[model samples]
Target: MSSMAERRHGISTPAASTQLKLRFIDRDEHVYFWFPLLAGLSELTFDPRQEIRHSALEVLFDILRFHGGSFAQSFWVRIFDSVLLPIFDHVRAEVTDTTTFTSEKRRQQEEQWLYETCTRCLQHLVDLFVQFYDEAFTLLSRLLDLLRGFMNRSHQSLAAVGVAAFVRLAVKAGPIMNETCWEEVIAALLAILEETAPEARDLITPPPRLNPAVAAAVATAVATAAAPISTSVSSAISSEITPASGSGSPSGGPSAHHPPTAPSGAAMANGGGGAAPVGAGGRTFTLREGVGARRLAKFRCQAATQLLLVQGCSEIYANASQSLPPGAVRGLLDALAFIHRHAHAADMDMDLRRRLAVQQ
Candidate 1:
């Protein structure tokens, strides 16, 4: 009677069908569907079209979110080798050009998008399988190598972004990172600061140019005003002009009118009359001699901030710090001091000043 009732309702056959479906999924047959999709996505990473690349990364992110944890270390290594290595190589090649032409600029924009996408995906994987990180030294070394390449590139914008990515990784993985890896990270950062320091010279102020029309008007007004001077005043002016003409002209040649050049050496010295001159408006404009120094100092401060944050969150940081070379610790302290000095010397933002103070 029960068998007849089950047949009538169609329950027994449907239950068997559902069980078969479950068995297929449990047997890992689902990989057949996902493997092809992932492979296609990985290939799409090399597509010249920006939208295709973006879509591929987005789909990959979704797939990773669902299956990243289930993958073995060997599988992860394969993914890194086959998928991520190509993308990183593409980015490195793109940034290497350093050209600012329209097409190159467009290409750079695309490369930046790809780089950021890869970074996010890497971060997600690192966060998802935190335990795998300790044993994934090879993976970390590859990432650092990529970042180092970016840092050494001629493009300041690209290099800066690379430094930022390095900082993010250091902060995220500081507690788990081995001492040797941490040292390498620090060395890379310091190298970036040193490399960028020379670029600060490009930021130096150029000599100011006088407007021709304004200069003509001023000259006419001065001539008209000087014509009516008394004989005594004229003699006094001649007396004052004689010495200047003598100093400007050798062998009693005609006095040449030359635009003033920016002073060097003694004129730029720190104290007395050598100090940077104040303008009529009471603003003092000083030449930027240490722009790179300031930038490096800021970089150090950022690193210190990350270290402090990691220390606050995990006891492993204490152990890691103890393992760090003494010079590295001293370098970090110097960076903090540099930030403090600059904050006090410049008209820095109050909020930033407060934050630095608190960090101190």
Candidate 2:
């Protein structure tokens, strides 16, 4: 009984003793081993084998999570440049190079692992430092740009991982995400849904808007300008008018300027074609080519990935709605509804459709 009590009094277990030691250990102790450890791990991240790279990244992330703020900014930047940035370039190269793998299945498996590692690393970086460091916002923007590129790739695996990562970022980083970041994420997700469910594209797509008052004014001005040109052209054609001074050569009959074409009011009102010149947000919006049924089938084949994205959508709606701007919130709501409707219409499993309806 005495032995038991004595043992329990101090350093009772390995964990307890370790914690006790940690409490007394100066933060400066890490300085001795930090760079050396980072150096070793940084080398491992570039290894040709995926497993080694993944393990190295896991260690790096663990260090960041536990002691992220303890180190100098330069150390963190070294990790960012040497360890994090290289992984991005490596994964991208691996995904695009078809000759590396002997078979498609192996390629996909390798790609999937690479993508999952990339996402896990990114999540650790953003979740650990986004609030405390200003540099993190820049990282967040770079993350969005990377994910956007991933979503644009032809591989279903790439798109799936991109969407999943995007959703996670939005749900986790909602408070810190600025308006531009929010819009970019929202735009990327909608682009995915638009590709996966072409039939419902119109439902979620934002219609081109020109202020009615502006449209009316522009149309009136165009009509007033076109009338004189039309009358002049008709009279010139009827009279078979010759060149007007320097407008055309005297020997050239019925000069090109004689039948000058003026844009009609409707054409001007339509913004030159069927689309608006620019959006209200000061961005030019253009739709991609229509996604085909084969692509939809590919999306269906990756049901797990699709479900991940759907759950992410629900999470963003449930947890981040208040943090988002009004426009983004409205866009998310519309996206969620569209997903539910498409799932039901496509005869997707009842549970998925339900998940879409329930936020988070």
* Index of the highest-TM-score prediction: 2
lDDT of 1 at 255: 12
lDDT, candidate 1, 291-358, per-residue tens:
32344454454444433323332332343465555655654554444434433332233322232232
Question: What range of 10 consecutive residues in model 2 has the weakest lDDT sum?
Answer: 242-251
Worst 10-residue lDDT window for candidate 1 reads 242-251
Error in Å for residue 54 of model 1: 3.0
lDDT of 2 by residue, 1-360 (tens): 764675777537666565545221223555455656766776677576878977897897777667765545555555566556666677677775743554988776776676676677656655665643544454555667677666555566666667766777787777777788778777767766655553322211223344555456546657788544355344443243221111122112121224313324543332333333232344432333222233344444445445656777777888887798887887787787866665565343332222223211
RMSD of 2: 17.1
